[model samples]
Target: MWKGLIKTNRQKEFFKKAERIAEEACKHLTKTDREASFSYETLKVIKDVKYPSMSLAKSEGGEGLSLYELLLMQEKIAEGDGAAALSIGWHMGIMMELSQEQLWDKAAYDRLVKQVVTDQKVVNRAATEPATGSPTRGGVPETKAVKQGDQYRLNGRKSFTSMAEHLDFYIVSAYVEDKDTVGWFLIDRHQAGLSIDKTWDTLGMRGTASDDLVMNDVKVNEGDLVELKSEGKPNAKGWLLHIPACYLGIAVAARNDAIAFAKDFQPNSLNTPIAEVAHIQDKIGEMEWKLMQAHSFLYSTAKKWDEEPEQRGLMGSELAAVKLAVTNTANEVVDLAMRIAGGRGLSKKYPFEKYYRDVRAGLHNPPMDDAVIAMLAKQAISKD
Candidate 1:
């Protein structure tokens, strides 16, 4: 489906490298999930491979990969380890956005990019708060950044901060008390009042280490602020394709495992393996169909985003549609795989149980299904 997606030799090389890293990471995925721990070893491999900086421009000391290429890399990594892919996707996507739009103060963003290039430091946005669930709903943040001479004192708690323990810098959202506007504050992890609370125990994607970030009057320089529009309308976020891609990878893994099991398992009651069974073949066929649909939608949307820059400004609905379709189909595919595997799927000895749980996390990711449907509905009504 993505024959010409990697147009250049450099892109092909990068994709091949990503696949190797993914194969290596897959070796430890079960242990990582079982322990519900962050894969520091896997992260070291990713850093060594420079996967996080792949989307940064060559001028910015990166590989200068396009959004579609980045998504392909993310899918490969998720095939190895979903939690690891999700965690790193945050860093890669943020870097892409910063490089493309130059959203923050140039000096500050330059310093951050230097760290990522030279030290492979990871960063993620800490915007979700205890008071406000999803920042996309347009709620005033309880986190406050008060101007104090040449610095600002930030005080608030952010929850569900993915890769909390590994982040070198956190892009925190807070209400500027003096300006009465919401803005993003760049806070270093080693700052005096910043701390991470160990609170990331979940049913799936446990390796993400999503914890609570507490900021108690942390002092930050004036340069650390990134101001946003008062209306809170976000720019077209093509990088969100990584979310569905990650889930799709997980579904693919699950489907492959089920097929392999069906081809080998034999019982005395049957002369042949389960693969020859009519019902088993039907279930596998359904899984393949769903996976193919998701794959086509995801890659087509990504290709469009890469080929037509002008169309991106109007692609918010299309992007959300891809997310909705891919994530929903991935979930269905995983379910079918589990059904095909039967009791063995639920057994901890097999990875299918973990895949089942991890795929469900896609439902809660950004551009949620309900929100996507509402956006599509609004667009249709307005067009009519």
Candidate 2:
């Protein structure tokens, strides 16, 4: 097993469980990748193991695993299947954020936290829109909600709704015309006029089923409208570290696979395995260096967010830096691993090709590269 930085016995136990899940999930990775299919069976396996509740607050009958621990588990799971990790990471991260921030109404949070613990119900925010792009970009949502006699009617479409097929609850963001602000509504899957558009076809992370969520005049109770709008940028969200952790997992998987192949494959021209070849050894060494750099940046940032509550709000720059550095480094690590794997790396018979594609998708995830760089530059100039 690769070296890990698990902090507690509870975390260690959960990490072992994640390892087992990853091992089993790997059995279907090739087939699922080939078909570009979503796997409810894989999700069921995760739910059956009660992995989603690991991040729920202990006060709510959960393990309340720390952000660091959660990221560790996310990375391990992604090693087996990137889409599975990315799919469920949203639920895990959202649950952790809600627990730590207490940003939701008591009744609403209590209602959902119970179901999460008792039923393994999953939830994700439907904030991205076809017209507005990422909500983080500060685009007011085109989805609008109108108050109607203690109920609110919502209408608009959401894009990149990952795990759309299985989410039990969707915390949708929409504009409230009367309030002149954005509001979040917790809508159930069975709500009328709410449907999945099956539009998530992509070159990578295809199994995420990140389809479009269609809401045509869907209505919800007043109590369901949980949070109101905030101006300027939102607060730092440490839970988003899961994004970098996940891609790093994919990179690590590629590195391990390359090493295994190099150690086993003895070319006709070589007296020994290619693992002894200087060029291959150089690539392996470089992969190790990059992995170590990314692991340090990601885990240290996560550890700080967990251990220092006072510093949490001030970690916006650090969070973005971790995501940018780890994701780009992960891409590098995977590329080097593919080099070690040679021509066979691109074959359908090998996993490196899939790793190459999936790791690149990390570049497109939230706290995007350009945004991160611009934020960093602004911060630097302000300091000067």
Candidate 3:
């Protein structure tokens, strides 16, 4: 879709450097104590660098990193602040998927990637409805798109539209009944009939402003439809490697905080640091071990997807497993971080409470944990 990407050794090194910069910039999100209260200025810094375009490849104005390198960047960014990382992670996934579907063009992608590198202008998929849950492909949409001459009219409201107010565009999924099938449309915030119901004051990911998108009769060109046949594809990969990668990073961020906190933490009334205590040490050890496992699994999964980047039937089951595992793992890690921080952790003095809230959303996020497990069970039985 775009050209002149970094496929050389220098470019790969640049990607690593960009990730390090993001890590250094975002490191305080976990330690903020009251992470939800964080302002948008922090996210602005990461966006300015267009670090989200890590998947663009040097040819398309990005580093063209393999899945392993991509995961490395995600882990580093999430370690900074899970919510911020999570907000950005969905965009990373979106851009990659758009490119894979041959929807991204040099004009929009180039300009957008440049601004994305450094701005708070988020790009995300707005498919979840207050009632529809995961908005999985083939899952009937509460929102409908009606064809009106050359343009389409979108009318509906979406919940958990992450980064709503600050985003540049929303790649929305709605049912286009004229086709007797569902379809996706890219709606720009600047369009008429589109408004943000600025009610996003999330307990966690507060900085993300995961607000609501209300469309009365937003008109957009049919050309804005990024993927014509993407919705009901055999596998419906809406929640695949992308979203999980973000939460996966956020989960790791929790682990990173726990490790750092324990290393220097002094137990109340005890003469030794918490790291010296057998029990605390044990918990920290578990956090570390678990984090390693997540890293291995997520990295392996991304690599496999990239290896066969075009094998797009549907990996709903696999994506669900990743989301469930990482979300659970992230929740545990943040919980443990809270425990390690003690009551002070819950206090607005550190990020534990906010992380707790943010991590909890993963449980409710589409590809719900229950759904994934059930699917996995079915897959197992079918194989048997």
Per-candidate Cα lDDT values, in order, are 0.87, 0.89, 0.66
* Higher-ranked by TM-score: 1 or 2: 2
lDDT for position 250 in model 1 = 87
Per-residue alpha-carbon lDDT of candidate 3 for residues 1-384, written as tens digits (9 for 90 to 100):
001233457545645654664565465554432333333565556555656665665666655556555555555555566566666667776666555555555555555566544443568888888777766534577888898998888899887777777678888888897887767787778999989886665566665667789999889886776554443335545325545555666666566666677787775788977777888777777777776666566666665676775653555566567778877787787777777778878765665676677678767666776777888999999999
Model 1, global lDDT: 0.87
Best by TM-score: 2
For model 2 the local lDDT of residue 95 reads: 92
As a whole number from 0 to 100, the lDDT of residue 333 in candidate 3 is 74
Candidate 3 or 2, higher lDDT: 2
Error of 1 at 97 (Å): 0.7
Q: Following a full C-alpha superposition, what root-mean-square deviation does model 2 have from the true structure?
A: 1.4
TM-score of 3: 0.81
lDDT of 1 by residue, 216-251 (tens): 989999888875545656678999898998998888
Per-residue CA lDDT of candidate 2, range 182-238, in tens?
A: 999999999999999888778899878888899998989999989998666678999
**Residue pairs in candidate 2 whose N, alpha carbon or C atoms collide under 3 angstroms:** none
